[model samples]
Structure formats: structure tokens, C-alpha cells
Target: MVRKAKELNLKNNEDFALWKNFLENVGINNFSEEEVNQVDLTIGIFDKQKLLATGSLAGNILKYIAVSADSIGTGSNFNLIVSELIGKLALKGIFHTFVFTKPKYVTSFQHLGFKKLAVTEFGAVLERGFPDISTYLADIKQTENPVKKTAAIVMNANPFTLGHKFLVEQASQENDLVYVFVVATNAGLFATDERLKLVKQGTQHLSNVKVVSGGSYMVSYATFPAYFLDSPNDLIEYQTTLDALVFKNWIANYLHINTRYLGSEPLSRTTSIYNKILKKVLTPEISVKIINRRQLLNGEVISASNVRKKIAQNKLNELNELVPETTLKFIRENAAILKLRIKKGMKIRGN
Candidate 1:
């Protein structure tokens, strides 16, 4: 900013429209109502009368930031807002913070000691050190007798499906060992614990298949911001590449994984693109294979989203064709709970 703001403003709704408009000018549209409501703290840097630069922090993630085009060259307001956000976090004894921003802003954050944890063409996830990838990688319980040609699958089995089962079965049969890392992020319809349980029971028959929590390294808000945004594009590429990098640089080596398996995403465009990005990012040492999605007898592809839609629409019989017996059993066990969630009109992630 040529003329920086003197101080930050209090959290109020008066400046929200201003904030939203600013972010929109930068080609960003993911800021949702739920996320805005989650903001427990927001500080806008004002240039006396006008809001020149502003941002907010919630759940330790910095977001909803925008700056005037004129302020692009000046570091004054950028530095000011970041310092204020960090200071607020520090007051709470929070040493770590995460920032979700565009690729263009990575350098500004780097100057503030933030590490580039994940970046995609559309969005970049940077962290100030609240449990980075290395921290998550350290938590994995490697097999005692690690297999030489190990395969890995990172999935958020939002109730687990036959498609997921098929992928696991193939990986396990092909490789000496397979690690099924269930995504631990808490954004899905089912809680992480529930998802983990379902994934475990659904894939328990394969002795070579190890079902374990992804521990925040896979599809996590830390690496993928699209989890928060529904309409994601080009940015998914960078995020996926960063994901593969984490696996190649960290998880792959630790777990003796030379091959990462993925089911061909026939449903979500973003995921389909992400699969392509993984092809480019995964080094030659590690092979990535995209398996075809399992299909129903009617030829429709099986997906968790399809399973959820069936449950939501009360088409229980159709699910029999879309899901494995194990998943069907689990859904039956939790029928009432699933029904209640569906009735409440909760936005269940079918994917």
C-alpha cells in the first residue's frame, strides 16, 4: 500500500461486503457462507476512511484477504495484517498458523517465515507450523516386514463403497503390500472415526491390505483448499502435484511405497484433473496407476457420492448394486443415523 493503514479494525459485518468484493477482484470465489460464519476473528486494515487491505483468521487458517491493486507493490499493509493475525494467534499461545491463498501471494508469505506446504494452479496452502506434513508422516505405523513393491491409496471413504473396495482389492492383489490411508479431515458427512471404521471393516478381508488413517497428509485442508470450495479448476493441478510431492518426498519412502494407486475419477472433474497432475508429479521411481472405477451391473459407475444419493433418495435397493456387501452391512447398521442426516438436508459429500 502506498499509504498503509494505521491500525486494524474490530470484527464486524459492516466491512464484509467490502472484503468479498476485494477478493472477487482477484479471481477468487470460494469464500462460502459457512466459512464466513466460522470466522471468530477478523481484522481489516484501513487507510483512514477506506479499507485498503484486510484479512481474517479462523481455526488457525488465514483467509478472506484482499488488497487494492495500488497496494500490490507496497508491503506495508500486507505486513501489517499478517503481523496482527500472528499476534492474535500468539496471544492464544498458538505458535502455528496456516494461510490459504493464490500462487501470486506465496512470496509475500514466504518473507514472513511461512513455508510453502501445498500449492496448486488455483490455490496454495502455506503453513506457519501447526503440524506440517512431516509431523503427520511421523505418525504412520509402518509394517514390521515392509514389502518391497508397496502400493498406497489415500481415500475418504465417506461410508465406504464397492468402488473403493475394488480399488483396494486390486492394489492388494497386485502388490506385495498395500496401505489404504483413510483421509482424517473432518469435513465429510460421517465423522473421521466413523469413516475410518467403515474403511477398516470394508477392506478387512485382504491380509496384505493395511487400513490406516491418512493423518492430515491426504486431501487435507492443509494441502487442498478445494475441500472448502465446490467449483475448483486449474488450482487443483498444483494441489494434486503438491500432494504427490508429499508422498514422493515423505510418505512413499517411509512406507516403502513404489506405486500409488487411484481409481479413475469418472465423476468429479476436479479429481479427474488431479489424477492427471499426479502423473506429472510422481517421480519415475514411483509409478502411479489410475484404475477404472467399479461399475454397477447396469453399467453405471459406483461412487460414494452415488451411494449417498441413493441413501438420501431412500433408494436402498439401488445401493445394493453400487456398494459392496460390507458397505451395505455398515449402512444398514447405521441406517437411522444416515437417514436423520439426510432428512436434515445436510450437504453430504457424495464424492
Candidate 2:
């Protein structure tokens, strides 16, 4: 009686408790309460009579993959659920995929078209045809010898779109290597890992780029506010500056990045303001380059808000035009689930 459905409402504490136990039983203990809530509702799987397993499609990686202890090795349920999830995301047109798997389940993932990456202290990073994120970025840090030009492209993927591709391509041309860091905070529509994977898939062909999660200490999804309150613009500006300072300082110390690139969009209220303030405030140590905003097929500027509006209207065609082909396909395949995401929160439509 195992079946896949896209509209199951499982937000209650009871449901979360069920998933919490299931995930811990599988050895993934560091994930938080907020993290589990970011699952795109549509990708959640139900067994014949109970919620037994679940996963979410993020960037090029399939994340939060878990199965109930009672359901482990029970028939082909695990295989079936994961296959369906991947199939859904694949239809969104993403070519390469990634997932974190238990050491014992490495073979199972390989059979499912994923190649295991060397284990990190955190977890096993796996991918298929996607560049190894760790080595993807070109060495751009300038030393006494003038290290190659390197740029850190930071984002809260919130589901990467075609606009992201344009920005990356623009930055990659000027730098030897582009480090794409997906903000690993629980503050937005998608969890940190999911957003990172989406960004990875959207930008995989760019040879000089690497994608990785911005760890908690540097940029917190938990502490950062995706939506500003009715507070004054200066306060918002102050907060933005503080966060930017924190992010830049960490990248310099940890990743050796010295240059940063951002998109310049005149229409985004928050970003436009942040840009104006940041240009003056960012330390003199790192170079800041802002690419002009990218445009949509209609010749108007494309934005995350616009893409979301199209998705909310079920206008898949328009959404696809705004996102990369892979991103468009991913959204369409998960359309049913994605549609439900609209109802989740007041501040973050998808997070």
C-alpha cells in the first residue's frame, strides 16, 4: 500500500516528533527543529499507513533523506521513495545530483546514480557528474605573488533561479575562481543544504566555481532575519552591515577569499539599500564588485520575488523563463509540493 502523495499536511509537533526520532535513529543528530520544517512539503513520503520516510530536493543535492527505524530494509520502500524524489527533481531538469548518505548506504546511493565523495568530518558528500565542491573554485587568493583573482559569491539560495546563473557567469569571467557559498541558515524558504544543492546544480558547468554551505558560526540561518520588521531602514542597514562584516571576515580567515561580488538590482528595496550602504562600509581589505541586475525574457528585471509570484500563480512557464532550465524543471516537477509551500509563513513564502 505504499504510495507517494504531494499534499500531506504534516506540520504538527506530533509529526515532527515522529520524524525527529526517525532521523536520529539513522545517525543524523545535528540537524535542528527549524531544519526539518523546511522540507518542501511536496517531497515528503508516506508509507501504506504511516509517515515512514522523507527528503527534500535542494540545489544539486537531495537533502534531509531519512527513513523510519521500523521501516528500514522493508521491501523497496526506501529505494522507491528516493527514486521518486529524484525523478521529480530531474524532471525539473537538473542534470547532476547530490546527497548525504550513511556509510553503509553508499552502495545504494551509487546504484541510484550518485558517486560518493571522500568523507568529511561532517558527513559524506556525494554527487554525480557535478564538480567536487571542495576543489571546484580556482585558487584566487592573492599572496605576495598576487594570488589569482578570487570572488566569494554569497547567497541564501532560497531556491536558485536563472538570475543566479547570470550573476555567476558575470563574476566568473573576471575572477580565476568563484566560491559560491549558500547561506546555511534556517532563516529562509529553503534549508541551508537544500539551497546550496540548488545553487550547485544551477551553476555546475562553470569550471571555475565551487559550492559549499556557509556553516553556522559564520552565517547563521538561525540568527539572520530574512524579513525585516517595520523597523527603520537604518536599523536594517546596520544589521546588514554587521552581517556582511561577519561574513567577509570569516571567508578571509577560513576560505582565504579576498574579493566579493554582488548583483546590483535597483528595484529590490532591501538589496538596493544594502548595496548603497555596504559599498561604503565593507573593509578596504576586500574588493567589492556589483554586477547590474539581470533581466527576464520580457525585458523587465528578473527577481526572486517575481519568480515566487509566478510560482504562486502556477505560471510555470514564466517561472521557468526566470530560473535556469534545470531550476525551471525542478520547480515544475515539484510543483504540487512547491505550491503548498506558499502557505507556510507570512515572512518567508518558501522557507
Best by TM-score: 1
Instruction: Compute each candidate's TM-score over C-alphas.
Output: 0.77, 0.53
Per-residue error (Å), model 1, residue 60: 2.5
Candidate 1 clashes between residue pairs 3 or more apart in a chain or in different chains: 120-238, 120-239, 122-235, 305-350
Candidate 2: where are CA atoms >4 Å away? Answer: 1-146, 217-234, 345-351
- Misplaced by over 4 Å in model 1 are 1-13, 17-40, 46-53, 66-80, 90-95, 102-104, 119-123, 141-146, 220-233, 253-256, 315-326
Q: Cα lDDT of model 2 overall?
A: 0.62
Worst 10 residues of 2 by lDDT: 221-230
Clashes of each: 4, 16
Please list the C-alpha lDDT of all candidates, in the order they appear. 0.74, 0.62
Residue 242 CA displacement from its true place in model 1, Å: 4.1
